[model samples]
Target: MYRYRITAEIRRDLERIELLRERFDNRGTLPRRWLGRLRRDLEAESVAASTMMEGVRVTVEEVRRLLAGDTPPTVDELSASLVLGYRDAMSYVLRRADEPSFAWHAELVKAIHDRVMGGAFGLDAGRFRTIPVFISDGSDGEPVYTPPAEDLVPDLVDGLAEYLESSKELPAPVVAAFAHVRLAGIHPFKDGNGRTARVVAALAMYRGGYRAPEFTSLEEWWGGHRGEYHTAFDCLGKRWKDSSDVTPFVAAHVAAQRIQADALSLRLATQREIWTAIEDRVE
Candidate 1:
């Protein structure tokens, strides 16, 4: 069997259902200003993330060109335009490819970090090490685990993959929650594990028929609640270290998803209102 780790397809499905519930609850009463502002914010975030990952070489006009169905530039061309090295640019393009699901394993996380940070951070892209890695603002710290020494990783990943494949029929929110917590507990990479886990969670949700996983910024949300996020992960990690039961992690995942859903609902309502106003002006 293909071993997998921390796949959360079911949890993401549930999130979509909940989104629908919120939309229905609001009925036709959403305001124009709110809807317009939310749409603009969402679009702005998308552009910012794309630029951050892709680099500064590609201008807004170039991005618009690509989005307008123009022939997409090659990785090398994009890199030259974005002022990034050839490999870094290629890696960014590959990660955002339509085939992102092709690399749904823990190893892929390291690969992505290395690709993104190789020249920028002078990191060795070939090997996984146990060095300490931290994010900006002194948050997101953890001792790294090299694969062979960290024997639990492979098994944990396999279990996660099995869970995902077996529970393919579950809701997206539940699946996303499952994938997020399991990956977070495993803490697979020396760096970028959280970001990678979030990406995987988003991918799981996307594959399960939800829109792109960029709706609510989990990173932005978790960054604001760093202490609580870490505490929840630590709680689950301790349980996994002792009993191997994932209930605690699952609970945390559900709670986080609900928070995200609530935020998304508010944004969606706001966007609906804004769009209505824009439409009225056009008329």
Candidate 2:
């Protein structure tokens, strides 16, 4: 469906992600107490960061509290609902990370959008758009990119599904990065396309074995460096353009993966240090 040249940086970053993944996975024998703590912490962080990127107004504190079953912040109703929906969707992705039978398809894409826009306004959950949509600058409201026609949405998605199945020889991170850029470029749904695209990227990383999917926080990295993130997508333009070389976008994605892997390794070590301090004090 799309074509890209894998540059040397892409190869190097992909290799780094895999190496860091192996180093971190060896710590899987972690004490259950710490593992559960880290899992809960990372889940809330992922929800907060991912939703915030999509313009959700809630804070990380509010989201963390919400995940703990507390009442939401006194923000707008949509903010709370959007974050909740995103949390559910992120949880679903993490759950499916290790499934050998999992494959990308149109129905699965619809389902993710459903989770993301379940209670939002002026949008149909889990369905492709029937009209044109333009993504614009948040500041000026000038259109930055125009998606393909509504009539082409279905076929575009079908092409992506086919590509995901056939690209087995490509590096998983590269495949996942392309999947994300294509999904967002297709802009298939009326809403939740961005959130859904990010989740799809996470699914690709998990499927590719880049790192333990449970704890990798690529969203966290993306949210922090959104300028680079948006620029990466913009560098490719939409799928139909003559300048749609995906090498830069894939390179940026692999860079984010490398950052997340290193961050996870350091966090894991820090958690262990804290646990040891507690053990020493108790003894």
Candidate 3:
């Protein structure tokens, strides 16, 4: 219930929460000028993080346009404008959508990858894989990792769906963390597993009433922290094998969120200050 016992998982990160609270509380009493500065700084950081997360080059003006309800520019448009590749451009669009669900998850991943790779991307777009595929390290070209057997996909998907359905009863952060770990552990599809997992994590947060936590670009953060992140999954895989026990994974996930929260809080305070200075001069 409440998305796979997330309370237990969150308990592992209490220290991180305390650190975040301390940072947040320390910035509580700023003057109006300082508040303005903080707001601007937060906006800038938000735009920068968002652009990075989307995996495209986007101008501040383009970001403003997208936020203001202008027709979202296509992946090709983003590629040309930002000088990024097709794959990166599509990743940006996939991550930017605020409302994502399980059904939409399949469709978006397939469409984005297809658009990037030139047609119906995965072996199963809306369906789970029915064959076992080896997950190899790009660096080593060896089949070092293998997912569950074909027969187990249905049960795994069912468990995930049930967990998502029960997520409403959980805390926002816990739900987000659990979703990320569980989905990534499932490794549902052969390709786009990581991206799919990140999108699922974001959707869980959106459902839990938090803004999509753009702590870091998923690819940037995960790619940079690949060793640790993979270690967590590998450790769990060896221990749990079939059943999902995402406690360790959740700990890492929440730690990432805590870092993002701290950065965002400080950035917000700085932006508030800058805005106040500009307003005071104008007045």
Q: Which candidate comes out best when scored by lDDT?
A: 2
Better of 1 and 2 by lDDT: 2
Give per-model CA RMSD: 8.6, 2.0, 7.2
TM-score of every model? 0.56, 0.92, 0.61
Instruction: Name the lDDT value of residue 11 in candidate 3.
Output: 68
- The digit string of per-residue lDDT tens for model 2 on 1-283 reads 5568888888888778777767877765877887888887787777788888888877778888887878564766777778888878867777876777887789888888888885454668888999888888789988888888899898889889888878878788888889888898888988789899988887777766655644245778888888998998866563345237777788888788787778777888888999989989999
**Error in Å for residue 71 of model 2:** 1.9
Q: Rate the local accuracy (lDDT) of all candidates.
A: 0.50, 0.79, 0.53
1 versus 3: better TM-score goes to: 3
Q: Estimate the overall C-alpha local distance difference test score of candidate 1.
A: 0.50
TM-score of 2: 0.92
Error of 2 at 153 (Å): 0.5
Off by over 4 Å in 2: 97-101, 119-122, 214-216, 238-243
Error of 1 at 225 (Å): 2.2
By lDDT: ranked, best first: 2, 3, 1
Tens-digit lDDT track of model 3 for 1-283? 1123446546656456555555555545667656564444434334434344335555545544543446346434533322222234334444554435434334444444333322333334335566777766668887656666767755665676676676577665666676666655566665545555665565565555554234322433454466776776654443226555666677677766666665566656566677768789989
Q: Which ranges of candidate 3 are over 4 A from the true structure?
A: 1-9, 12-127, 212-224, 238-240
Model 1 regions more than 4 Å off: 1-40, 43-121, 124-127, 130-148, 151-155, 212-217, 237-242
| Model 1 C-alpha lDDT per residue in residues 164-249, reported as the tens digit of each score | 65665866656766677666666555544554455556656654555533333354355446666666554443233523455455
